[model samples]
Target: MAEKTDDKGQTGQEFPGFDPKSVEAYVVKDPQALAMNFARALENLGKAASEWLGPRERGEIGDSVADPMTDLVKTLSKVTEYWISDPKRTLEAQTLLFSSYIGIWTRTLNQFSGQYSGQPVASETDTLPKDKRFADDDWMKNPFFALLRQLYLVTASWADKLVNEAEGLDEHTRHKAAFYVKQVTAALSPANFALTNPEVYRETVASNGANLVAGMKMFAEDIAAGGGDLRLRHTDATKFAIGRNMALTPGKVVAQSEVCEVIQYEPSTETVLKRPLLICPPWINKFYILDLNPQKSFIKWCVDQGHTVFVISWVNPDERHAKKDWESYMREGIDFALTTVEKATGERQVNAIGYCVGGTLLAATLAYHAQKKNSRIASATFLTTQVDFTHAGDLKVFVDEEQIAAMEKQMNAVGYLDGSKMATAFNMLRASELIWPYVVSNYLKGKEPMPFDLLYWNSDSTRMGAANHAYYLRNCYLNNTLSKGEMKLAGKTISLKDIKIPVYNLATREDHIAPPKSVFLGSSLFGGPVDFVLTGSGHIAGVVNPPDKQKYQYWTGGKAEGQYEDWLRGAEENRGSWWPHWHAWAEAKDDERVPARKPGGKALNAIADAPGTYVLERV
Candidate 1:
């Protein structure tokens, strides 16, 4: 150990600049300044405390109970001893703690400033540092954190009252809550709490990483690290899909679920409809996520419905396709496949199933065809997808100019938004479920991460072009132009109110990425009647869950279906799968004729392949 000396009798190296009696922050970065300052504070506290305690200890004046309070004050003075004694250890501990929170807060703050994983506006200039991406104050004034802060305060207040009022309470159990509450509540202030008592702040921040505070690493850390991954394995998975039991028709008809997968359930059933169902999948994940395996496979389910379903599996993007934008996706991806579906089926119209962002593109394609009075889309279904970008949820935080600029800078450095970074950001959105708990079980508990279908699915993230994301964030979310009748598309502004086709949309109640408020709002934006159903679970699981599992509840029985909310109120409260409900709705809309064509036989001109290039890039 290095030999050290202190001028004030403290146990650490002396920083003569600081004098706590003067209460000045003299030595800015010197570690020794902290120890010296703490020592001086204790010395002053001791002198005054000794004077106050002398008479009280001897049993004199003001209700001798003041003696205990005086002793308490004196005991608190020992806090300085640790600071002045273990200076190096103190600094290291404090650094680890505060830096942990700084990491999360810093990144989260950026997203609100529109510093998204994908830069929506690559041309925009950067104005803020990464740390101060969007210092709008209101950006940091997040509803979640604000609510959390208030809760912490209430928790601290309640716990203190509980222990103080309940004489028989267990002190040990109560102390744990008290310690955690004290630190969390203070950190909730969010205004440089680190400067107050950095050690305390550091401990609080680092606790999130360590699971010392519940829900810190819920998504990022492996559950096994804490002990074992708690996620139950529902089924075995193949390269691209999972297994689950769902209820559908039995035969050779192509059936598509809101999850964006085509199920060929009973491949030998009598085929229906005039066209073989072709599924236009989003270019985000592997095709198997929709087809996973036997039980959970939506593709198998479709075949059982007596329809031949062909799905599009997109190729993962690389530097070669760096210039490819949304237009390329529309021209090469959607339109090209629609023609192939038409060719294969010999039918004028084929049902289209789109999911999440895929649903948006499908709607866009519908708009493109509707402009020309083209009637190829017989039916449409949107799964956790959106047309109107109002109330875009936490994802909005990352749509600001600064955030975009940062993304452009980062992406320009590599030509694409690194798939992993995007994955991490989404994980942080629901850190409680996606990140922290596992960290505890892994690094702290000494275990391995457990495997779940969702985790496997999540790990398979997709790369996005810098240009496409920029246009999406700006034109859709930032401007709210799509729902406002201001979105300019295909040489014209396509009004959603013009496409009077029947529609079915699925929204998840617990989805943080696409909240029900936002997803359900799209129902009202449509000109045609919409059957919007809110499902259980988050974005992915809610849509992928099979009806056979019966683990979900849905709301049904709405009005005559003129408006969104009207239908919502009248929709009777019910339980079980929305799959059956969707099936019935689909069957009612069908022509009951068997249609057999190759692929891309819809309305548009055929491009090259059946599913096309972009949709086939799967895991």
Candidate 2:
């Protein structure tokens, strides 16, 4: 018989052909190593406490303490006032919640009594939903625990209804209340507590509470190492090294500037497309994400498909780059990159692609160039990017006037917005998936983190300039000026509508950073034909999906100018990577295939090997 496997991937019984003793033999832990780990953790805790108590870090502590409480107070005041004014409606909501829980218990009881054979309640999304926190735990399957889970879900639903129905609250205020409500509700999940969680309790007992000690040690170490706020090191950092195991694409640094370095990848095909492809990755991360490994590298895939690929490796900005604004990124970064591509490939017109914030900047550059009547770009592609920030997802919660002002002060103090701050915000967006799970595994259960390439990339973050970050938050996010044609760069007002080139847009169905609807809206802004493809998985996984993986599916035939739902209604689902579709579209745009060109020509000579110097700059 086949062995049963739990969610954590541990089999209930050993494989029929394998010896259980062999597995146990390999799973040895040294007491001396554990003692050393403990010692290091203690040292880190003292260092962290000293830093936290310091005058420079005290301001940050104050903001951290104030912001959450401020939002909580506002939410509570509004909720209380609404409840007081509509006691009848509030009571009705409570009644509905009670009814829902009672109905759940009735069904559960029926199943227990063998009267029902229906499946247990599950979340609508295959992935865990934000509010349905108790869905994954097997303990929750027990009749008693199941009822508790149902009660929590019902209460959460009722809270959301109350927050939504609260009259006299502004949209922003309502969103804040809903955000806080979700946080509070999510914390109350059965999975979070050892007493409530069977798995954690089992592990705790099995380890004789050594797991708790290990967890505390790990937590202290991370805190000392300055990643405590984010919590849990998701990847074994010692196992993988950059430019070795990770980011291993072969290329040469053909061009360089203060803000960016253009890496022209080695051609994989003897013949290549006439219009070379230039990739502008977000400055918020290392460019190596696009070229993570041989099998997963999009740049390698593009090259293999007979296209000369070039990627911008952004500088890890410091105080020296503090004065650099969005315009600097445009003029010195994208503009310079275009010149470098032309110089190297001898192609006056090149195809450009951008991911995340890079796509936002690319859109702006296209409009900026259009204003100058410079038609250098043949086509444009956006990967999980947002030009319209009006509905830019939960991230909008951190883009308010007060938040922006506070951010500016913090950045001013530091010269750049620290990568950790950005990492913390992004983690909060999926706290259940990213943050709390790590907290549970690393702290509560005292397990070592599994090595993951993607999580490592996620942790490998980059700083943002004070001026640039401020401008982006205030203009693009706060005012929603980019889509409105109110955003200006180099003395000219920019608009996404002026981007008349053939556009290919990709959005992930489960992306928290760039919602599919928000990404699809960029299609309407473009003056040219738009091909928007919605793929399964979250932001990074959705884009990095290579054909060989065949892990997730994507949908085609979506209209860029229509509502996301309408597009979804008529779209055709395909069972593999979107790379082939993208490559076919790109090839159609180019004139003809020609003899492959080398990395550099006369003006733009190859400076250094691929995955260049700037990528090595870690702050």
Candidate 3:
């Protein structure tokens, strides 16, 4: 044991070095002593919260050993004692405080959330049958869940060791240690604040928007004695969509396929598109992301652009569709969209635009087609999408063989990944962004939240087929073989190098979910001519960006020569929205402008509305 020196009376003194092997970034002295003491003052925070609001009665908080809020209170007490004794060594303590709040939030999220759209937590979907029985299987072994569990164990072990070993650690060191605690704790109980400290929750989630909407939801739930929110808390609507596997008819949209139905908006088209544009949206979300409303819908924009657009709205997966894998998605879901588009436009080759996971599936679809030598695709666009799974980020933290087995056990019982669980995982990824805002308003402020169009849109989540999710995780993230040109799908090694089609990959600069690095991986993965685009804003806004939102400014650095590495090295930096640049590129590649043909054919079928039926759910 090294004897550490501490000259505390003098505020300004050289920090003594501690054993580096014992801690993750050992400090010479506590730099944040005062701050740690401040956090220590919050020692009564738990009791205060308990008395003012209420004690947590949930399983994780009330039952689990890794419960964060309880741990926070304990750590706060220790810090307070240390502060009262010698406030100089408070950094580690302050970090512990940080851990308390963060851990509470993360753990709470883990406890409440049900399932994600397609992403798995811990099951081998390949061997399991697809259906509700798949989800019912024991998912404790899920890779994601395992990672989550390990996150808890590792954090606790490290935190405990740091506190036990360090001596004369200033407030700053204590705070740092505590912060480590918060990070792991938050990873487990991100939504804990919602139950323990709702005030903070609402503010974080609300953002620039007010809490009127969230409040309205609570009021509806209260009035109905828990009918959930009348307006829907982004999750309910999405979950409902997942369970039902059908688009919601919120009385706002009616699906139709008539030449007159589509042409009514266009008085007379001057030029016809050489290739039809087919839109493929992820089944996990409502198709409206492609063609949301007139202001944001890409489908509407494409249709108005004189390009015949056909959008696919996937049926929600249920117990019956649990066994349906990527094969089903390609053969049934996406193939249906392709056929519908081909029939509508009387064109064989068409442009395919896919968003998020839909983009992944689209690439797979084209692979299936290319393997069969049926190349009807002229050009393809991927928005904030990653074909290569090497850098998928926090989502990867949940993937591994052990976790996969655990999840397989659960999904095997249920037949499909649970939508609630999927939603929970995403929420954990962005706990502060998604959960906190609701906490502050409804619980602390006792106020209502404004109905934010964006939050409302975010709350909508969906489910995925068992085999499809299993195939994606195993082939993409865990294997890291997708970008390496080593992914086998539908009885064939799906090689990105084989497809010689023109590829356009778009990514957001500040995106957390789909980081630019991951999205840019497509350039190298695809052997075809490639164009890498850098967009402004986040994952959703970056892709959903209609020509000019002006909210963000984009810079293009990827070279247009189509080689990903060469583009990375030589990619020039430009200012302003790349939408114009994209349009120009599309126009140049487009064969020629011909006479506008009459809209519709024998394939035209009338259905109801814009957002389609799958996305609009009230529960």
Candidate 4:
């Protein structure tokens, strides 16, 4: 058997003053300064401890009747049994790991002896995934760190192979196993720690423990901000405010309900499309993601493109609104938006856009309307939404029967799931990118992250109403009822097949929340002329992409039929954002002209400014 090498290695990657040759370079020459900062760091750690315990002391923390991690342990145990159950299989796994380590050891010895060239020594077959965490040259140039990196990689790769190759395990179990393994490995990565991470170690030595002091102080403050939970700051929160800096698109809250507030943006163009545009954003986060700033504001872009835009800004639900379910969201939210759009623009019909879970709700609403012969919605556009959960990515791992029931018990106690809980789950999906990077930069390096509108919006999570969340998990993820035509909304059973309205289904190439394949499969569910467009980038960037920036490319002219791969093969790629392309497609549907409408028309009076008070409510 041949050993895998770093065929895809970082060849010319350089870090300033990263040479391991100077032992004196790492010496903490200033003992007094180091001691002083170390003491301060300890004080900050104490503060962090107090912040964590304060909530529990005041009985503000949720009761821990069910252990979520117990399920994780059990899931991993199953995988463990698959390997250890057979001695020969276990030996083979052990041999594979040992061989990899041996190869690394031999190469390091040869390099030290000046017998081996300073090039990749292993074969391409033995290559590991390109991990940005170990991008520092010390991970390769330094023998100690290089050995540690290889050992960790070999072990992680072995664990992954075990789950993937494991027989007799059900598909769901396997998925959960794989996801858990990845998470566990990510959490245990050497780069996350100050001592193990060469870069963090250098920073610590250079700063004479000052970085730790600052990092610990920030850690304490973040814990206090999260009400005892670590609300890790991915960006400088001080640099942004909802209406002042972010969500700056001018609009007015035309209508308000317990479940949502309908905001109608002030038109930018002299003449607007006869059919208004209603944007239904997921309640998992704030609606302002679409209106982050003037540069990235999708709402503003639509308003400028000659469309009267109305968005449903969902409330951050509390115990008082615990009973609000999916039907309530549809009736008081999406349906309410339609009504608000009509009042604000005097148009009975309007083009609708739904993003993520909001799109799932919109699909359900369309089906319900179809049965009742309601044709208020002229056309629909779905962005990174999953109507079919069959291919729904790792989010499904958190939605099994046992887990959902456990989650329901927790939500039932509080009447809603904490916004932070959902935020953590999302961050965990891309833990390597979202979680560890921030941990290294903010906590380990003792540095304040730069202000990023997208990350700020990412952290601004929204609470999930108990009833609504339960319905979604059970119907959408658990049974996959929505796509199967078995989901019941209100008193009637709703099917995606009944949604005959023209659809502009946009799936991003790299969407993790709603996988492209899942969205592609969902395109076939609607009984309409579906124009499925595949765009570049993930869930947020792909949808929020403006044509002016011309960042990622998009693909079109592919029929939403057969496998997603097949569709991709025949699709035509176009450079730049899909916003302009979508606008043209929508205009082609109904290009009738109407004078630009006011934020609040004669029928509906303005309740508040744009973005609304509902979005301002924090959990």
Candidate 5:
């Protein structure tokens, strides 16, 4: 890729002094740091051991262990009750399951006798969407293994049906039960077993036990490292440095607060839009998702499109920030950034965009401003954000009273919700895609993970303040108070309906974190003209899509009538990235063109180059 010039027309090849090799070497061989980490690990283990003996912690542990059993028993009872009430329907389901098993067995017998030639049965919603797992193993393709896999899938499907369709259960109860059933069934898949998974067996034989030995070493090292939880390293740490490769957007940090720092990018166009663009990114992770590389950087694209862009790089909170809450985030984070943007750009109104949780915060901030009768926001855009959490998909399974209390206990003990814990929860949502693949590759096959930018960013997580997380989960996820106008922040109860700015919302088709339908429901809450777009691909890939790649198609012309299916049906499919469409929409809302501005302005001076200090802070 060609090197782009900054606002001052200065060409920079790389981050000034980033040395990946030195950083990697220090991380691997730093004796003092290693000793400190080991000491911390021991202390943490000691505390955990003591806590296990305490009454409160014991009760928490007991509840944790008993909750699953309680759910299982409740589901079984519901299923039994339904069967007793409706024998005919119950018999039909049982008969279908039995027939499915018998059919698979018959197919296997016929295949052995050279009488069967059809393909093996597979679930449309199989956890492993990709088929490369068993493609190279002839044994896996054989009728025996195929039959085994088919039986597992059919059984899992039936279990899920039983849980979801059980009578005398509320919708929430059914969803929770179905989620647990799916999780249990996924864990018990034939693919996870050594005898059934031909590929793992092949890998074991080929490595001659070396893979297992290496996996053991990795596991031990992780346990002693004090990071807490097992994190699969997706790339060699020595291969890439943060500012140099991951967050390479050319800009400068113009303003900083306790919560966030604002980065103002160098204008890539001679004439820029009169209204500046400010981005509010999620604090749960680094803000570089929109600025991964030149080819994929949305920030660069916006700069090149003649819009002066400003992005908020959030501080990765630690124990010191444990008391920070939702109000702090709005007042010290988004509100601070908005003020900085207005002062730096000398623009009365600015266009703003938010991603994921940041979008949630942005909506709240806009509402807060509306309550104060402020109108600094010209237009608003939300990317993969959920304002209404009624149907937040599998993540809702973890938002109930018990789970939230458990999470609170964990966070309270540590002062913050450990990023690894959050990462694990997300990985579980797509275990077949994210977690197990890494487990098999790194452990069973003894292979090094590929150095992919996206995966690298995924692994680089940020801790969440205990107070902030508790407030967010309880108010937003648990109570569904944000859309209901009952969420109190900064001593004010803000409502989404009060914000009347024109809105552009984008949702991914396969986003498991923030389901498309959940994101679409935001339209109904916004008291403004809403243009909703549905793009192809999952959460991260969908939002990072650039038009030059021409990879995924997006659908436009959807009116968010609080129904995802209806919106999708009426939407028109358009090829290429939704970035161009967003740019056009943003430009239409912007003022007339003006001479481009530099990174620093008269009021707000530049503190440091972009991908600034806040992003470099390690928790």
Candidate 6:
């Protein structure tokens, strides 16, 4: 048998075992420390079990997990029915799996016999997906792990195909099935398990199982922190504190309401835009995402650009605020912020911006204002906002009748949806990046994740009032009422077309929460002039991208008509952040200037420091 060298020059002889150098890399030196840590890890594991069981023992948690999962099972059943119901299709699926498995098995045998090509045999084309999970050398060097990786990828791809080609299912059902398939496949990936994952296997062996001990200890701590639920930690929570290191832009909470605190940021310039800027951030997460740090803070950037910034920091709602709905948010939250901004700036009209769900609420408010002929907001900007749900992306899969009903029942039980629930949902949108990577690093590698301001802000989840969430899911996602001229607000049917304010609608190209297509389609619903700009990156990074970072590009001069892809083709791509483009567009709307005002003006007095107590309230 001839030895084969891979692209990296490692020979076929390295196929079966952990190379000495590889094993030596993770070797633990202190036996005594390892033993002590192992014992501590075991103790923590026991504590974790105790924490998990304590709630069940006291009947604090319900055993009704299946109630919500029932919809998922039913949704997935449609795909199963499509395949299994037809004998020919079922056989085709089985044959596809068996053929792929046979190929992998043959390649494994060839490698073991030293009669293989150096190129990977992980997929049919000898090319693997660009997945970091299988980046370890052992994944391709070791026959066993290679076989597992290939088999898993083939099966997962087949599952996706099944959903895609399935017949007799409605579009919604098909989308839900496909989403569930991705989730199921992601969870069952070989990299998720210690024995199956080559890297974890090496770490465990070299550390004499010390890695497992540390991982278990961390797992216990995470479960305990989640109050018996596993709140997967993405970053070192202890390293971040609101207003201390994160959300560090100077400001003061000048006005407080039942639903929100209006923070008037200290102006950075001697003179500021006469029309104060009011930001409405989604209650689903803390407003601090926009003000994560001075470097990344959009609020700080706006202030520096001579805008008197006022932000609405929504409360982490509980049972008391569960009854508050969208109208409640409009009147008490946005309207309250507008009034506060007026008092603080001595301005009647202001430029307004909304992010994610916050943008949705702002759009509705604009429509309501249009109905009332209220021109308080001279210009409106929506960041990654969706007015139409036709192409709302994967999130719509979770908004069907059964799922929303289940969510309503759960939220009704507590008067508000737990912040963790929403956080988990958002994480699932990019589980491959958001959920699994952290799971592997934190619990399997026994490493504390790096402290990141953006991730810390992401982890600081906020509860949604029962009425508010239900109304949002139904009106925006389910009914698509907001885009249609049918959504009733403040006892009157309002339309986006009637809102004649100059609009700067910003959509991220890679946004999952609000798909670019949905945002583009939504632009047509507005009667006023809309400057629809598309920028690079996903939901958070795309919006928070600062010009100083010189990261990501933005597109302009494209009409938000026809397909998003079509518009994208004609759009001019410019280097760097979209902030400057937006700043130019907004300043064009109304660039009047006045002397910078204090945190609280002649009427309203300061309530607290910037980032307000409402944002500080944790779930």
TM-scores, one per candidate: 0.57, 0.85, 0.62, 0.95, 0.83, 0.94
TM-score of 2: 0.85
Q: What's the C-alpha lDDT at position 282 in model 2?
A: 94
Model 4 agreement with the true structure over 1-619: per-residue lDDT tens digits: 1122356863531322233353354567788998898899999999999999989999898566557589889999998898899999999888988888788788777655555543555561257666789888777766567767877887899889989999889999999999999999999999988888888888888889899999999999999999989999999888999899989998888899889999888888899999888999999989999998999999999999998898998999999889999999999998888877777777899899999999999999999999999999989999999999999999988988888888899999889888998999999999999999988898889999999989988988889899999999999999999888889888998888888899999999999999999999999999989999999999999999988998999999757999999889989999999999999999999999888888888888888988789888876
Tens digit of per-residue lDDT, candidate 1, span 399-426:
5555566666666555666565566557
Model 4 TM-score, all chains together: 0.95
lDDT per residue as tens, model 3, 452-529? 445555555566667777877787767866677666767788777777898888888777667777777666767688
Best model per lDDT: 4
Residues 192-309 of candidate 5: C-alpha lDDT, one tens digit per residue = 6655666655554544445555554554444444333356676665577778877787889999988889999988788999998999999888989898888999989999999889
Q: Which has the better lDDT: candidate 1, or candidate 4?
A: 4
| Candidate ordering by lDDT (highest first) | 4, 6, 2, 5, 3, 1
Clashing pairs in 5: none
| Quality of model 1 by C-alpha lDDT | 0.53
Instruction: Tell me how candidate 6 scores on lDDT.
Output: 0.86
Compared with the true structure, model 3 gives a TM-score of 0.62
Error of 1 at 495 (Å): 1.7
lDDT of 6 by residue, 299-331 (tens): 999999999899999999999998999999999
Model 4 weakest 10-residue run by lDDT? 12-21
The all-Cα superposition gives candidate 5 an RMSD in Å to the true structure of: 14.7
lDDT (0 to 1) per candidate: 0.53, 0.79, 0.55, 0.88, 0.78, 0.86
Worst 10 residues of 5 by lDDT: 17-26
Model 5 TM-score? 0.83
Between candidates 2 and 4, the lDDT winner = 4
Q: Which of the two, 4 or 5, has more TM-score?
A: 4
Q: Could you tell me the lDDT of residue 59 within candidate 5? A: 56
Tens digit per residue, CA lDDT, model 2, 577-608: 99998999998886498988888866677888
